[model samples]
Target chain A: MKQRLSTLMVAAVMTASFAAHAQQPAKKAPPPAKAAAPAKKEGITAEFEKFREVLEEDNPAELFEAKGEDIWKNKKGPGGATMAQCDLGLGAGVVKGAYVQMPRWFADVGQVMDAERRIVHCMVKYLGYKEEDIRKQPFSNDQRTPDHVSVITYVAAQSRNLKIAAPQKHAKEIEAYRIGKEIFAYRAGPYDFSCATCHGDDGKRIRTQDLPNLRKPAEAVKAYQGWPGYRMTGGFMLTQQWRMNDCFRQQRFPEPTYLSDSITALLAYMTVTANGQVYKGPGIKR
Target chain B: MADPMKIRAQMKGDTAEIRVLMSHAMETGQRKDNAGATVPAHFIQAITVDVGGKRVIQGQTSTSVSRNPVFGFKVKGAKVGDKVVIHWEDNKGDKRTDEAVIAA
Candidate 1:
């Protein structure tokens, strides 16, 4: 009886999906000559791409970058020290081309740190802002954006058009990459889903959104770059760290703590895999 | 105090192309917040563009505009090195003005 019921359920699901497809507007139906092509999906993707192209010309992310530049140069926090002197891997006060080489081993912290982590560290060290206070509301919401996100946006924009060259020189950097690779494939949580489940292969998508294959260099660059994007839906500026946390939530896994090492590891792996691609600065997202 | 706008003016042939990106909440007043309170309406109401100290474009906007809205204008008789100033006033009485020079 149970076997028969399971079969019946499967049949119902198939019928429901067929009905959903049938309900699509007649205007969206492909002509008979293009029956063999995935015309419907391609059309939607193309439309989205066109929309993105139009919005990309005047991205709102630039506004955040400007705000960040102001914050970086101005004195604030308890220490009242400007972040202008903050060292972002290359040396103190160097802003250009520092973003593309992030998730590197920072000897001062003795850990592999990504761009967001390094920015927060500078905020703490130079600006005297408490780490916990900053972590309390790290992600942007509809109403407000955290200062660090804007700072990262500014930093990332400085590296615009630079090639991604996430260093794997140090032992710790290599270890972070390895751990990131593992985390990408490790499956857990109620959904039994991993990042690789959705992104490990090409031509994968969730609903209408195409998922880039993280394992392939070409596709990995697509996934890695254009982050720290300005999300049009919410008009909020978000960083890759927020993206990674949201991914975990979608998989029904426990969200990692803000500025955690594991999140840095994941970023290291993705950035390293996407090495050599020119980052197009901060991007606009649908 | 309101944040400043980003203005870019460039010479496109004889006409000067002016693009402005303004930052605002642009709340429609129809939407509710996470705590179920109605968010107040706040949006840019009037916009004016001055080219070489002459008013070239004056317009009004409403809640329909998106947050951090971008506006573009084209003005004749403006040359490179001409000053383009954009000023906007919101419904809440907040205002911001920013200027840029037309570039070749």
Candidate 2:
């Protein structure tokens, strides 16, 4: 798989190099200084768009979504209940159109929650599973119990195509969004790294992937919707909570309790900031 | 498990460039050694990058990740000549850290 991807990468880069060379004027007439700036800007955008197109064909995230669906409908947990009955904030057992409205306030829960937390509630309340039981199992060993990996993939897939509409109607929901926005900008760690460190700007990439600016709508919506994806690096489906926890680990801050308020807040910010943008995740990622 | 992980970091423009070489088998638990016994899964559970003691990026990883996963990303506002440090911990509780100076 890796070899095929490398070959494709080389082919793409070579193609771009050839295309770029071809586009140059044969006479090499120097354009006006004013024209040069806009040309450069347009070229950069075009290049990035092309790069995104190349990656779209080979996203590895599909495999995880497939597996996640299997896990979701499969009966598990102490009660042997499938997740089909779990409510994702659209109503009990309602899977479709639930994700976009999430990070919203649910009076039943009395606190703001994101997709992951809501999944946990279904596992605990409806399925009669203990929270500790799920957390204690190692990622590798745990093959059951509404496993965070599979359920997240399943839930996120359900949200695919729905526009982000994280509601802020309730006071607590609004508070969560406020806290989430603050968390996104807060910088505290041994290295003083904040989410802004990598995501504050446009037109930057880590290695091959572009880092989306979280402060912006179009980019944030597109990027935020792509998680709960099957990460090529992790080799399994992951939810946003897992994504956020991993981000904290990389940030060198103590692990944010998985599915904690901090993560919920972050999701709130992302969902709200991403309002009206469609979700297309359970996506493949490198 | 006791081996020291080698870490190197550099400041490249507004981002802190980091590379970590950890001593781990990163066992996928899907592999069997020649002895036919399944190798238990072992991999880095977390990695963190700190610039001048501020948290930047944190990641949760697993055996599916590449061995000695060499991850790189930039932290905005990290200037040249700043100290960039990287630390990693595996499920086994093994820890390693390394630091490098940012270049102008």
Candidate 3:
């Protein structure tokens, strides 16, 4: 199965690159500027990496983590119950190392759920929040961030340095992974683009940002790690689900419903593929 | 109320390294919103750090700082277990104070 996927990906990359080259105007740029472009790009990328390293030492995500800890222990919501008893597949109140093992099957809900999805589910089931209300503004904007994103950040921080171990023991979990793989390769929409178009091969980049090859385990971890990240541009917390949603938007595809199964399936595929890699906790992103 | 800041204080050879992460919009009031209305300038105007009951840092900041700003300071003659308190007041008069104990 893996061999066939890689072979297909090579073909896709060939056509994609050909299309890119064919679209360029038959005009030559000044030779000097063209010669200096790659070197300048490398310099900027290295400097940006250094800046990120410094910022990571004092990540603003820590503030959200503190806030999330408060919400988990405090009594609020319509149910007036605390989320301290909520189970994250590791047992109720067991937060340590739970984030890395998520996108797992939950028998109670009879479905597979990612970290954000499960947290929202617990908020509804235990804390008595209306799913509709929570879904209304699931993402963060310039003004404010919804509570659940903070909660995910807090939870992810607890699993720092733990290996990714998203389980596939359950039949449904296996099913979700299969569906996720199909979804990744499935191409449709105005551009006829799939996730593979940008991320199926090594050395693919969108401008200065390098796209990780999710099909390979080493590169797959790059996709899984550093999520539920604190984006410095807008200074807002964002989750993997939001990243996936934004990708669809960039592709000009219809937006997936918040906490939808399709997103969970995709997460399962990515997380399981990234098994055994260490999660560096909530990250600071440019 | 604003979110609580995350403060870390660690002792490095008698100097306490204090790093604070404060949560604020730090709006410069220069940028227009989606509706084209100017965003009101709301940034931390004052910051003070106290270690072991002694004032160590009293600084002023402005709209130039980014949102969710981070600040680091090193205080000499600090010991382990010394209390490190960070206080900040924004242009809107909103204030927050958070403290941490110096770790070896």
On residues A53-139, what C-alpha lDDT tens digit does candidate 2 reach at each position? Answer: 443443334434445566567756676676776767777778777877888787876888887788777778766768887777514
- Docking class for model 1 is incorrect
Local accuracy of candidate 1 as per-residue lDDT tens digits, A1-286: 3322111111111111111233324344456634566544576776567667756777889889999999888857675667877888989889899999999988887878999999999988888878888888999998889888899999999999899999999999999999999999999999899999999998999877899999987888787766899888868899999999999999999999998889999999999999988888698877
Best by lDDT: 1
Could you give the CAPRI-style class of model 2? incorrect
Worst-scoring 10-residue span by lDDT in model 3 chain A: A7-16
**Which residue pairs in candidate 3 collide?**
none
Q: Which window of ten consecutive residues has the lowest lDDT sum in model 1 chain B?
A: B70-79
> Which stretches of candidate 2 lie above 4 Å from their native place?
A1-63, A74-84, A137-146, B1-104
Between candidates 1 and 3, the one scoring higher on TM-score is 1
The DockQ figures for the candidates are: 0.10, 0.02, 0.18
Taking the tens digit of each residue's C-alpha lDDT, what string does model 3 give over A109-209? 88899999999998787778789888889999897788888888989999998998999899999999999998888898999988889878888988777
Which 10-residue span in candidate 1 chain A carries the lowest summed lDDT? A7-16
- Ranking of candidates on TM-score, top first: 1, 3, 2
Output the chain A TM-score of model 1.
Answer: 0.85
Rank order (by lDDT, best first): 1, 3, 2
Candidate 2 chain B superposition, TM-score: 0.81
